[model samples]
Target: MKNVTSLASGAVTALVLSLGLAGGAAAEDFEWPRLLVIGTPGTSSGSFASTNGWGPILQKETGTTVRIVPEDSETQRYRRLTDREDIAISSVSASEMRYQIQGIDGYSQTKPVAQRILWHHNDTPWGYVVAGDSPVKSVQDIKNGGVRITQGVFSPPMVSAVTVGLPAMLGMSEDEVAEKIEFVPASSYAENCRSVVEGKSDIAYCSPISSVLSEMEGAPGSIRWLDLDPSDKEGWNAYLAERPMLIPAEIEMGVKTARGVNGATSNFVYSVPATADVDFAYNMAKWFHESFDAYKGTHPLATRMSMDQFRKYLNRTPLPVHEGTVKYLREIGQWSDEDDTWNNKAIETMDAWIAARQEALKAAQEQGIEVNFENQEFLDLMKEKTAGVENFQSRL
Candidate 1:
């Protein structure tokens, strides 16, 4: 990936630099859409990097004004893009995508942001780091030692991806694991890294793919990632069984820090919600595929973009592919009978989850619990009860 001139121009196209639409792919131009509003993670994130670069290019290519709106969190961005009343598109973290689709974890109380997959880019490992000077070098050390870990309290990617996955992998519950490590919750990754450097936290849950974490590694206090026990099949099974978005990752030279051989998480995903019109999504995706090569060199992560990664993760089952994406896949001969089967299964799985969501809501109301889940209490309750979520798992 090329060096970004601005914070908004990071490698996420690399993922930020990484690149994405649909009607079975587009045959012609889309009409009726005067403006295409794009939602992305805040100003300095990888998603923002892509937005910052792509907006201008898209405008130049299509002769349309690209309004890139920034949201503080992935959830906020997803909410805006998925809102029927809003005219916008969003790029989201795949980690959060899993939770939002399942209506579990941090999204338990929120409405499902189950939109179509149009574009994909950026695949980074997910995990945490300890001070390079610290003695902790493995998951077991952090799990068994009196290590203090910090993460975003309400952030789904942090909470579900690391905050909770770490404990599950250790064969303990969150409360039980709390006895060994002090859990420090922060509002942002910058704060998490600051806490780590100041000795307030022994570890900060992160990945090298993040510019912030990469910067943290270069700060006064350097850090190293904890290696998971790759041979621990039970542990790996338990952790991944809950969160399927992550695949095994061995990150050596990352966005900032370098890693040794380790059992980290990786996947080729960086996606935007394709909820726009079929023709629009198709044409949009088509243009992106064509323009992708022009921007991949703008950021480190952008340089990681490839057609192979796109084919592998773009159409992962249970995450519906937009018509526009389908068209592109077909045009490239990437679509196959196997994909058709999976896509059908994905539709079935989604139906089950959507059905379960309603069932869960109705059950909550019958027990005097309002279905309106805007607070922590309701979200927690929904996760704990599992009411209708169980049904969907069987379908999956």
Candidate 2:
């Protein structure tokens, strides 16, 4: 009887161990991607340059190969993300994404879009630049002047705001701004900087770290960084009021290089969308977190990134956080009760916003009318459409 009992006990133990191994294998499973394409700017772009290192590291660590694909504008990347055309992730300016979602300014003609955010890397800042010899020293210097600023044709709305939002900050109407400001269109930041160098542009809008800015600052023009000084209360307040996305960021001040003068400018973070396969997203986040140390060594800008750096920007996230990322955050006890409340409220709000948007679209379609957000009737119609939606008040 004792021998028989021993045999039975050993069999049970073996079965339990086998089951545990199977569970572990499932947890460690990586979904082999057909293709993973990351949307980026041109090879020379600061945004895209970071990806050159990231692609190899991602492939090695996650067992998923990542392809670096260049795109000129956020709107262009938006199409791929919306279509889910093997585009696993892309880096876009958070401010521009917010602007696009609200369908404001140059983007007013397009319908509002909804996307998810995964991680926000804060390595880039945007602001106005000009020849150091130019007399345009401040925001006040541009008003009532014949200054032509080149707002890049393919520039993210965040970068382009310096030219347009400046007028709004100074309490001028859109028409007044249009009348006073001459906007020159260019194809790239490189061209925009050249405009400033060749005297075609008075002040240039640029990402401080771009090669174009560096090139001009080095050769074509020794540039001075222009910003709304914090000490100038009226100017600072007005700038903030006009451009909600402009946060006080410490930008690299350089005479075509790092001059070591700390200046305030607009900065943005790159994010991932929610439509990404949850398992893939979950594994991606987990892989990134586990390999955080190794990944940073991949590029110069990445040296600034950490797991906390990824989650810390959730406050300003214009869209919903990915479920996979949320899972990783929850596991680490990083996501809090406050986060839960906010996320729940946010999700409810977004759902109502989309549903109401669809309802309004249907009304317009049936009536064969255009739903202009600026029209009073459109506001009234939207109010009527969303009035019954749950948590509609919270969205307000």
- What TM-score should be assigned to candidate 1? 0.68
Best prediction by TM-score = 1
Q: Model 2: per-residue lDDT, tens digit, 222-311?
A: 777676554555654556554555554446433344344334444345455544555655666676677778777777766545676565
lDDT of each: 0.62, 0.60
Candidate 1 lDDT over 71-115, as tens digits, reads 777666556555432434666665566667778554666665456
> Residue 254 error for model 1, in Å?
3.9
Model 1: residue 51 alpha-carbon error in angstroms? 1.4
lDDT for model 1: 0.62
